[model samples]
Target: MQKISQKSIHKYLRHDKKFPHVWCPGCSNGIVLGAVIRAIAELDLKKDNIAMVSGIGCSSRMPVYADFNTLHSLHGRAIAYATGVKMYKPEMDVVVITGDGDATAIGGNHFIHAARRNIDLTVILINNYIYGMTGGQYSPTTPHGDKATTTPYGNIDPTFDICKLAIGAGATFVARTSAYHAVETQSFIKQAFKHKGFSLVEIISACPVIYGRLNKKGDAPTMMKQMKDDVIPIKQYEKLSPEQRVNKQTRGIFINDTEKMEYTLAYQELIDSLKVPKGDSNE
Candidate 1:
């Protein structure tokens, strides 16, 4: 593999210094973004060959900040757009970045179908629990009994376990990591990128300004500290009792497996089997 430097990766950054970031200070989205950039740099993937697609929401803003060929698409349609991109230009490294609501709620259908088809795409779901960009509305990943602007009486719905959902949807690779664990998050992103078929990385991020304040999770620092303190390493988790594991454990790498015959590959095989000579007209 070709080696690339951080300086080279920095060149691909799209956000300007003068404008500053739109995200609130201490938000974990910045950390997730940094990890993603590091992963891409480590992989040595060419900037021009990579295409990043995003749906509407705070997380959707990520592609705008990334230096790759970016598309700020409609809400819950990022994966749909990315699927089209990959189907057309199979060589392109297509990535879909979306939020919990964008991926699991309004875009729920697209999410499952993409995984079911095993499209060659990497999906990074940045979940902050609430609709950060549109105030503190409850999202699909919002925990039960959590308070949000729209759920003033506490959220009654059960939250979606994104990793499990991805696995159930037939994703070749599925992993969950919190934003506080930058190293693990980057490593997981690298693994996801390397996985041949559909891959999904559900990153739990801190939204201090919106979700944090609304849910009384304290400031960004406190929320991140909670994550760091609560998240048990996968190795350490193996040693823990079942009850202990239930009490305080944020597991890692929940699922990782390869799938045979990804959608594009299967399509190509079908075409090859047709065996019609090029430029020949069949009667």
Candidate 2:
């Protein structure tokens, strides 16, 4: 028997053409990308069977580097595109790559509807707490007092609890993890892909170039350590009262395997039932 090297996963090298990715040296997008690839490899999915869709942002550029059927669509529309792809090709694995702004700002509506319909797609939302692509603007997930390009004086808006929103909007699987938790993040991605209904893995990534520098959140290591310190696992979160978990960075799966009719299969069943007989029995 011949030996195989799992460490040399082919998909990891798919970014060679665009080597030296656009993200900054300390940015965690690369880490998150690795997690996605590792998850796909572990799932044993063929490149042709997976479709990676991304919106317009630093996180949105993931599709360009992955060796899969990919679509780099407009900002805030990745979920919309992924929804269409899943509807037309229900068997294909569809994963959406979006940033904090792309997922919860302009793309919020699409995100909501996709979860509401229980679309069978995996959404990897990289939340760096700001618009990394667009001049470090305060995003929907930016902390209330964080500073951004637009919020030089400090952001006064409340942040969106991404995993909670996904669960509330009807996603069947919702999990929270950070880029620093590389192995766990990969495992979560695999779980998301394996799930039958809408699944979202909210990844807290580091944006040292923009978000971190603007907000004085320290270098990449410091920011990552912050997440490591603040985030709590799902079981631990469950132990806390509602007031205790308030404004906390909760990690782990919020929902898993909740029975829901997947949108694509439901649609197919509807069409199948609507088919009329070609001829009456008496005819």
Candidate 3:
């Protein structure tokens, strides 16, 4: 075990002002952000060689805070932008910071296709189960029967299992953790970054102000407790009866290092094969 100082972490933050993050007190976005920063730091990745792309939402704001080659793209278009970045500079580390709504709603098409291609991109989807930045509307990942601004009568629609969505869509590496488990979240993130093909680490986070207040889930700490209590370790989850497993959150690595053809590499091969030699080409 090595020591990591607060000072070391601060160096990665945007230094040209922007003090006082706008996230509400007890919001888990900051916790998730710290896990991301720590994972990148522990991996010893060069700041310049890494690129963070994000779409519109609370979680998508991660790119603005971190010192990296960042692109704050339009709503639900982060992955599309990131795909281009990865294709153009395949050597650079490309990561997407997206919210549940941003990744699964307007962005769902891009997300699934990106996963299907098995591109070398790490996607960190922070799932607070509500649209935290946009008036706490119901989102794709919102639990069934949960109350939201848009769903005053309770969410009638079945919620999406983002982890399953990623795995089914062909993500080679998929995992889930929570802001309450910072070290575990960071661990999964590091693994996601190291994996060659598409990887997704879904962080179950807290939105105390909007989602929590609307649902009467108490303040930030209370919501965080709910996050911690909601999950069973994946190993233990397997032992539970099917009846017992309903609505239980399971943490830990679901898939690791599954082999797949990386899209960027295949694309490069295509480009190389089509390139004609300078002397062989007709004028």
TM-score of each: 0.90, 0.92, 0.94
Candidate 1: tens digits of C-alpha lDDT, residues 1-283 = 3344667766768747524778889788778878788888888789999999999998898888888999999999999999999998888899899999999999999999999999889998988888888898999888889999889999999878887888898888888888988888888999988888999988888898998888788988899998887667678878888887653445588777774567888888888999977875764
| Local error of candidate 1 at residue 33 (angstroms) | 1.4
Residue pairs clashing in model 3 are none
- Model 1 TM-score relative to the real fold: 0.90
The candidate that achieves the highest lDDT relative to the unseen native structure: 3
lDDT of 2 by residue, 1-283 (tens): 1122456555445746776677878888988888888887777888899999999999998777778898999989999999989999999999999988998999999999999999999999999898877788999998888889899899999889998899899999999999888888998999999999999999988898898898788888998887787677877878988898765687898899657899999999999999986778577
- Name the lDDT value of residue 137 in candidate 3: 94
Question: Which segments of candidate 3 are over 4 A away from where they belong?
Answer: 275-283
Please, what is the whole-model Cα lDDT of each candidate in the order they appear? 0.85, 0.87, 0.90
lDDT of 3 by residue, 128-183 (tens): 89998889999998888999999999999898999999889988899998889888
Candidate 1 global Cα RMSD: 3.0
Off by over 4 Å in 1: 1-8, 15-18, 234-249, 277-283
Residue 260 in model 2: lDDT: 88
**Clash pairs (backbone) in predicted model 2:** none
Off by over 4 Å in 2: 1-7, 237-247, 277-283
